[model samples]
Target: MSTHVDDADRLARVTLSRTIEPGDLRVTGLVSELGAGKVLGYLEAAGEVENHWGFALAQELGRVDPAQVLVQAAEQGIRFIVPGDPEWPTQLGALSNTGALHDRGGEPVGLWVRGAHDLHQFAGNAVAVVGSRAATSYGTEQASELSRDLATMGHTVISGLAYGVDQAAHRGALLAGGPTIAVLPGGVDRPYPAAHAQLLDAIAERGLVVSEAPPGVGPTRTRFLARNRIVAGLAEGTVVVEGAVRSGAINTAHWTTNLHRPLMGVPGPVSSAASAGVNQLIRLGQASMVTTAQDVITDVMTHAARAATGAEQLDESFVPDPVRYPQSAGPGPAAGISASRR
Candidate 1:
């Protein structure tokens, strides 16, 4: 989709947003199934000839004040880009054919995107780095260094913005002077965990924080699972830094794999409990091992560059030794890596 659209399409998208329920699969399916121009038609066919369904659905969802929600969405400078809209990401559209598309748990009829940068900029070239919330210092350092390296190479880093690996990725990308996107499990206005409020604010200001849920929706167990699909969908590949045996990060890895995106894992020592899952992924052939950002990016970016430019093959490289951080590195308050593990 192009980054420009007609005023009518934008208004229709806003109207659709007001109508859909938070995390309602039926509503999201209807939007995806019918696309933009036909959404009103489908709603009318369901009942009501005078566009009553749009306003009525808003009231039924108890969105504080139906009219107020629309007003607030507009006041915040948020714009909704539906599937057929020019700004709708082409990469996201590809998901529809794969049956692995997340579509933000069928809540968002259109993304309520804000910030100076266009949302499609993320689709330009993105990769997600996710791992356990209880990450070790080694996992955190790998995530941070990988994020920074990717950002420095003009790639947008994507993550969940949780503690541990997620936080490290965001800080690393920010430190590298690059934009990043945090796809939240709740509303854009609602940052989960509450403790990350300052960090989230910084991301929304300098980068982008996105969600499929409506403005007032809070995070939930189900919402967290749904958000992972989005992280996988938005990026060309996903890298699992460190996770526990049954971690949510594994869900994102599976989603990426199912969607035919490359799945990479940052391998850690077998002795580290935090890296056991990552090692398992490598062992099972579900993901390739990546010790550095270039290892992962080579598969996603360099091959494409080579294809486009007809360049000769290049030798593989590792991250600089001086910058390589270990899991045993003593943690300080600023680092955010778990101190207990240190």
Candidate 2:
């Protein structure tokens, strides 16, 4: 079912994935304007490069064997996804205009996906559950219960595949036989924590293992920060189970707010240091307080309806200029499509 053009495009993106730094919006937009093949050609044709994108990417371009990269990934049961593919999640396009965050921004040029769930489809109906890695028992309990309830409603729970809150969130969804997605900072073929190898496998069997990095790449601090946007971008809204004022969970909430999506936070004991950040978010009107699944649903639905009403009956096809985008993030989360199928 793959065309020669499709194969070439996929290969170009695969090579670019290794060369380009993750979340480089300038280059990503260039890839969007010019096709991947043209972009690769431009890089190859340049004998010496001055621009950061071309310079940085050109160095790696010589080292990359596109065909070999694709073959290796395929051998590992990993697929390279470029824009326009059936499984490509268009919602990521919103990142193009999200501006840069800590010098990281832009939709991925392509994704390295493992597992059977369809990326585009499942991403549509997803909700992100993120919190601290050093989660308290109460925090983990809330995360699990909240995700379980959301899953029972057929909403997919999406999270970074880290320890603490992220792990608990994924488990809760699985417990309810609900769909879940594990977004990783490293290669989907390799588990990060190593200890979570079994848990990651369980997620792959039922949901998906997604990443922006290519196979064989290990995670770094920058990659971890870049990974949060994907977690927030894929979902209609984000729920912070527990976050310190400076935790990654709060960082995700910032992305949720930046995306103009509904942001919800669960309150913990005021005296507890673990709850400081989320409490700040709630206090500052950065996020609404959500204690139950119904609360999250109400906030999500209400915001969706209000956004719809304010947009002059506009849909995904008509984004306001203030949003800095005209691209459709695709219809808000839908059912999951198997990764191995169309």
Candidate 3:
């Protein structure tokens, strides 16, 4: 299944992944224009005369030997999937349009994957469930129940594998014997929280644990933020169970909105601070209020079916325009929900 050209491309992407930070525009642009092998060749050469940033990146590239990294990854059962790979999730292409997430918005050069399940299959019919790590019991229960219900309906549950809501969601999906993908901020081989080492291992055994970083790299705040885009991009929709008004979950919601994907939020007790972000999105009409998993499945499938058939003539009352909920929009509860046709 491997060709010489495919091997070279995969190695080049692994090198690039090690050389630059995730979502770095400079490297993305260079790889887009010259291809990864050429970019590596350019880095090997010492003739870079302009762009201080490019020069610095080239200097860093010289330190990494791509072949060795590949060996290390293979020893650990990791595989690098490039754009041409069949396992590469095509939905990630939507990230190219999310300029607000990255300065040089483009598809990832490659992904460092560690799992037996195909990435494309895991992403298909997926719904990302994200929220604050500091979640309350109510939030945790809701996330778990919703994920269980979604998984029972054959939708792959996707999350960042963080604490609280994410943990609950992943566990719920696993309990239902459904595939669950954990998009990591750090390397798939290095679980960030450390406590989740067993959890991550279980996920890789049954589903997937993928990242942009190489094997030895650990997570930083910046990596965590950047990885949110991948989580949002891989899913057909994103659900925020509970979070503050300014949390990473909200950031993921923004990415989902930017990609024109269905965004859903589970309402929690108004008295709980953890529910602030979800309530805010609902009040501003940025997300559809989804109380149950059936609500999520219906909304996601309805949107997908409509898009597939070019049936853009849905009743205006059923489709809420996200544009109406600008960042500066004031607080007001969303209007009545449209009845699900199914």
Output the number of the TM-score-best candidate.
Answer: 3
Cα lDDT of all candidates, in order?
Answer: 0.70, 0.81, 0.81
Over 1-342, each residue of candidate 2 has an lDDT whose tens digit, in order, gives 242347778878888899877776666777877888898888876638575446656767889898988888889888888777778777788877777677787788888888887887788778899998989998899899888878876678999989999999999999999889999989998897999999899998999999998888899888888889899989999999878989888888887888889999999899878888988999999998878765676566656656767863435453323221122222343222221112
lDDT (Cα) of model 2: 0.81
Q: How many residue pairs clash in each candidate?
A: 3, 6, 0
Question: What are the clashing pairs of model 2?
Answer: 116-339, 117-339, 118-337, 124-333, 125-333, 125-334
Q: Cα lDDT of model 1 overall?
A: 0.70
Q: Better model by lDDT, 1 or 3? A: 3
Tell me the TM-score of model 3: 0.87
Quote each prediction's TM-score: 0.76, 0.87, 0.87
Off by over 4 Å in 1: 1-27, 36-68, 100-108, 302-342
Q: Tens-digit lDDT track for model 1 on 223-325?
A: 7877887788788789999987688899888778877778999888889888888899999999987766666665665434444456565323322222222
- TM-score, candidate 2, is 0.87
Error of 2 at 276 (Å): 1.0
lDDT of 3 by residue, 190-287 (tens): 98689989999999999999898778889988788778888998999999999899999998999899888999999878898999999999999999
